[model samples]
Target: MRIISFQLPVVLSDLDGNRKRFLKAMAEHADDKDVIFMLPEMWGCGFDYKNLQNFAEHTYELISEIQSIINSDTLVITTHPETNQNKVFNTVYAVTKTAVIGKYRKNFLFSPTGEDNYFDKGDDICVVDFKGVRVGFLLCYEIRFPEMFRLTASAGADVVAIPAVWPEAKKDHWQTLTKARAVENQMYVIGCNCSVMHTKKKDMDCGYSVAYDPWGSNLYESVSGEHVLTCEINRENVNDIRQKIPSLSDAMKVFEIKRR
Candidate 1:
């Protein structure tokens, strides 16, 4: 499967402008088929917590607009603040041209960002089959949790997609955790991050959107800017690595023992 990670500089509180930018990005890859496009968390609103409620109100419309732009074979994955039954969630959706294939609400809210105060946590892990490969969805801060990654990989996910709004200060942590998740799980990891720098505050994003193969090798990585990093992912490499290492198979026995 081919994967494209889009590192976009989203404007805070500028929903219309961001949507236009997203559409423009999609246009570049409109004709491409059998590809997965991964965008950063809150790509439409740039982590503007103050206006999250307003954004959540238009989530359905925004999703529909995005869905209209892509072809049937391309799968777009991104996160937005969603309102469901009067409750809000930081949710990621896997969308095809026809319908939404999967949705995963972020379970581990970033306490430092006060996300826990505004959004409800999700209880379920989401894994979807795209074509023949299984893909898992995870939001920004959840990358810090290995248990979630293990659970998704154990569930037969060949690739894990992470949409993030990570700050520049924690770039090292982001890089380390991304590769660690891929290495430990023996699956491909696709991390898409925002590049918009906050001028009024000290907070800025380091846009090193990256992809790691099953052997923890860097397949594609971008510099600190807006970029579309595209690369082909071979599922055969995943099977080969797991067969050679067999780490996940061993870990399953340990998991069963702990359950008892």
Candidate 2:
């Protein structure tokens, strides 16, 4: 199946503006929902980490305007300010046209700007059975942690997706880690990043949206620009790779991790 790893250069705090951009991108790839359509992290607010709570989409009803436009079975991944009990969170929501399947709170929130100031960290990893593909999710910075990747791989994930708002200064880190995750896990790894100028921070958002096959081959990727990297993920390839090396079997003995 094909998957569109969408990259955006979002404008912070401009909900209507960003929605327009998202809809435009979706319109371009509307016919391809037979595959999976994913988006960058905090897509609604670019790198608007500080303004998270200010324009939070406290209810799914509030964003029904956008949700209504999306077709059924489209896996559109994006972040919003979520309310769980009295506490607020910077959470990524996975939405289909009819219902919400699941979400992952940012586990490794970047704090150099005190991301903790606006968002709370999520403790659990979310794995979903999507479109005959076992998909795993992690927000931007979480990809740097090997344990997170291993945890997902252990759960029998064939594909892992990371939605990020990576900065230009650390662009190399973004590319290197993305390829490494695919190579080590032997699963398709997709890294979607923001490609806009940050009004709050000095650095520009890097737009190296990429996809790697189970063999860590760069199937598709772009430089620092706004683009969508679409590629077909063959399940047979994922099965063949795992069957050949059996990294999962090797890892089970060498490293023990609690499975959910």
Candidate 3:
């Protein structure tokens, strides 16, 4: 399967402008099918905590517009602040042309950004099957947790998509963790981050969006700029690596022992 990770400038609190940029990016790959397109966290609102309520209210409309641009066979992954039952959550949605395939609320909200106080935590992990491949979704801060990746991998995920708005200062962590997750789980890892530099604060996202294969090989990596990186991933490589290493299988036994 082919994966396309988009590193776009996310303008804060400018829903209309962000939507336009997103549409423009989608236009470039409108004809592609059977691919996965991943975008950054809080893409529609640019991680604007103050206006999260307003953006969350219009989340459905934004998603509807994005869904319209997707090909029937292409799966698009993006994150937004969603309003559910009068509470708000940082959530990732996996959508195809027709409907939303899966939704994963970010369980690990960054305390440094005060996200934990503003958003409700998700209690469950989610994975969805696209065609014959099983795909999992994780939001920005969730990438720091190996247990979450383990759960997704244990659930049979072939590729894990991490949509982030990671700061430029932590670029090394972003690169290291992305490869580590892929190597540890023997699955493809796609990490897409925003390219926009924050105007209101000292924050600037490092747009080193990257993809790592099962063997910890760098399939593709973008520079610190806006880019659309497309690369093909083979599931056979994942299967072959797992068969040879059997690390996950061995870990399962240790987990069982600890549980007992």
Deviation from truth (RMSD, Å), model 2? 2.1
Q: Is candidate 1 or candidate 2 better by lDDT?
A: 1
Question: How many clashes (backbone atoms < 3 Å, residues ≥3 apart in a chain or on different chains) does model 1 have?
Answer: 0
lDDT of 3: 0.86
Residue range 132-232, candidate 3, lDDT tens digits:
88999888778789888999998889999999988878888888998899999999999988897565766576788889999998888567888888899
TM-score of 1: 0.95
What TM-score does each of the candidates earn? 0.95, 0.91, 0.95
Listing every candidate in turn, what is its Cα RMSD in Å to the true structure after a full C-alpha superposition? Answer: 1.9, 2.1, 1.9
Cα displacement (Å) at residue 184, model 3: 0.8
The local lDDT score (0 to 100) that residue 167 gets in candidate 2 is 80
lDDT of each: 0.86, 0.76, 0.86
**How many Å off is the CA of 4 in candidate 1?**
0.8
